[model samples]
Target: MENRQENNLVIKVHESDNVAIVIQAGGLPAGSQLGEGTTLAVPIPQGHKVALTAIAEGEPIVRYGEVIGTALAGIARGDHVNETNVRLPEAPALENMPLATRPAPSAEPLDGYTFEGFRNSDGSVGTKNVLGITTSVQCVAGTTDYVVRRIKNELLPNYPNVDDVVALNHTYGCGVAINAPAAIVPIRTLQNIALNPNFGGEVMVIGLGCEKLQPSTLVSDQPVKIYENSQAADPDANILSLQDESFMGFEEMVDGIMAMAKGHLEKLDRRRRETCPASELIVGMQCGGSDAFSGVTANPAVGFATDLIVRAGGSVMFSEVTEVRDAVHLLTPRAADEQVGQALLQQMQWYDRYLEQGQADRSANPSPGNKRGGLSNVVEKALGSIIKSGNSPIADVIGPGERIRKRGLTFAATPASDFICGTLQLAAGMNLQVFTTGRGTPYGLSMVPVIKVSTNTALSQRWHDIIDLDAGRIATGDASIADVGWELFHMILDIASGRKQAAADRLGLHNDLVLFNPAPVT
Candidate 1:
């Protein structure tokens, strides 16, 4: 098959569906056969729908093998199907329904799953080799910044393989209820950063002694160099005192680290591509700057690839719990067990309560940009947002910053905010992320490489540097969803091995962070 195209056509998303949708416009005849079980006539503009078979009024219209809407009027084969004929269904009532359940698979070992990665002393595999300077509180942020500036301008050039010099800065640590048991949250967050597989070498942690978050107490068996500014009578004087001397010492330390890193990189580069078992793959699905096409093209295509990953024995994670509010019913049935499904429901309930207490409507989503792109309500946006997970069984539900212990498909329940969800997913040990966007986004995490997929051709052309793949072709009838999905799968493997740079990396836009907040202090 031809690799990519520049036209639009109607496509039948599922065999059970009686209608097809328009993906693109131009250069097609009234009666043209495109692929197996699909045909078109005239041009169907992007976001418009077409009929696959005759449909009677009130019958459900299926996309991605689930009901996206119901027919409002009788529709014929070869005719456009859209808002005129289809209306969104009422939110599925999940409170009374028994949670969805799925049978556990008989243990089938995944075959040949491995990546060229750094093996830490602790046995965890790292995707990148870097030296990090972290701070325990906002007060120490400046010190960490000074340390990083000195390293980046003077020491880092000597070590070309070191990915970056980053200072983890945040707004928390000193203010608010510091004595609350919840204060452990910041400490745990810091530990997660140090333990992240992205950091292959030593880390220098700096902290203000007066802060409730004591840097000395957060020690780990891992290799880290801790420094407390409070010990010095003059903190600024201490910083100046360590400048030149510490710079020279750090340069030598970096040289040795780079030598070891060079050997690791060479070995990693020598590792040739092999057919790794799909089960070894763990994917995180996220959406931001969404538009109407988000649910129609990129989201479902991601879903297709997600299914392929699962069948290959790899795992996938879907977050942004609030965005999928109305669509959770569709996912519950696929849960690994009733309890898993119930856990998801309970989390959603808690999210609703939190929002209610804040005097915010749970349905007030689809940010301004989303509405400008033809999305009307949170319900409409969410109906399309959940497509990225595919139809894999929901094997588990993970809390914020929690590690995903099981290997099957999982749901990391996080707020709809992109940065917050991204941080949690990376903390949960997701090495790679597939972020879909219709409006375009330039955000990425410090450690994990984000592969940005554009839902429309216009956005892809406008922001080619940030978009790694274009799902617009599916909308334009230029590529089949399955074909695009497989193409993305290979692209992911290449990215994992550092063979390709994601759009965010190319733009140097990788310093976004978000703290997952589950409740509010009233």
Candidate 2:
């Protein structure tokens, strides 16, 4: 993992890696020496790979000691290695992957790490005390949105303790195959989001009575009992139907929702933050706008923080099905047991089928932005993306939209899309999110505070207000992964305890929640 930066800075991850990524701010010009004997045959962009030795035609292009692709043509030393000259190889076969061969590292337990969080009766903790209004169908979204604005502007000020009001609006619940097997993904996602600990167990539903999926069906009848001290009212009692004959006009409908929201707000306002152990933390890990530096810097730094979280008895989840697909073999061996290993394979196979159903395949990834950032294809991108999980034994696996009950690192299967992954993580019970980015994005969630880490100092300098931490120091030799990891851990406690606010939260930058609905829409 050492990089020589005195001359032309280039990162060589492993001794066997035939290529090292260029780290110069403006890239190195042709004939520039890279400290190594090799000279640049051509100008290389920052983050792009530079060949260290001549690669014969059809030879494997290696990074992280794995074949990311094959050379399409002969290459000279220091020649740029990119999608143009690289041909993607077949994804590793899902069968016969090593299962649970690596043992979990033994480390002294991390103690006395605590944060101020709202305690819920369900024994789960909440970082934010919010009122979440769930909608049974998109038909009620506009009305719910209007009422939520009213709740925030009008009633929210009255109840000083409630953090915020969010309309759990989505494009599901109606005009789809409600009974389809795949429908459970989005349906359970919405149901579990309402149960997100941040909502403080006060659930309200707004619906149009004529929809195929009824409001009562959206929330379970025994939802209150799931929590130990839950004082939630009946799901039916809190549901407000816009088309219920009692409402004469739109104003009446808005008033009904407003009144319903007030009761929830009052209960939520009464709740106060209390000191909770770090073990209560459920952190979700994700990466977007990734470049080659992601695996080298930010993601690895996050991986270190992830291990710290798990060492403290806290839970951490790393998701993105396609991102992990190519690197699944590396993960399967780290599973806690054979069953967990199989579960990892199951998710990969399911997603493989999903892509095929859409007439697509794994190569669909490495978005244009990704390629511009030095990722030649999905394999290269995946090798960089999975670094955030750290080296913990994956204790469990959960499919899309399923709630995670096991602690430690769990692989929550989800789409590679930023919004979908965040939404599913919310349903999986994440109270905070640490997102790493190299290419840069404004992605954020209204439900949880997002702590953004920039993969490079350049992006950090340009987007100082948005990025919470700069891991690029690792590339420049200013900091080690442990330095940034410990820093991020302390920062998480501060942000989760309400002592600090994330930049995204401060700017009110939130992306809309997008549900993963694989079922056919009619």
lDDT of each: 0.66, 0.89
Question: In model 1, which runs have C-alpha deviations exceeding 4 angstroms?
Answer: 1-94, 100-110, 179-187, 217-225, 228-281, 518-522
Q: Which one wins on lDDT?
A: 2
- The residue ranges of model 2 lying beyond 4 angstroms of the native Cα positions read 1-8, 221-236
Best candidate according to TM-score: 2
Summing lDDT over every window of 10 consecutive residues in candidate 1, give the lowest-scoring window: 233-242
Which tens-of-lDDT digit does each residue in 58-112 have in candidate 1? Answer: 8877655667667789877666665556766765665875566545444444355
State the lDDT of candidate 2 residue by residue for 253-276, as single tens digits: 787677667777878888999999
TM-score of predicted model 1? 0.75
User: What lDDT score is found at residue 457 in candidate 2?
Assistant: 93
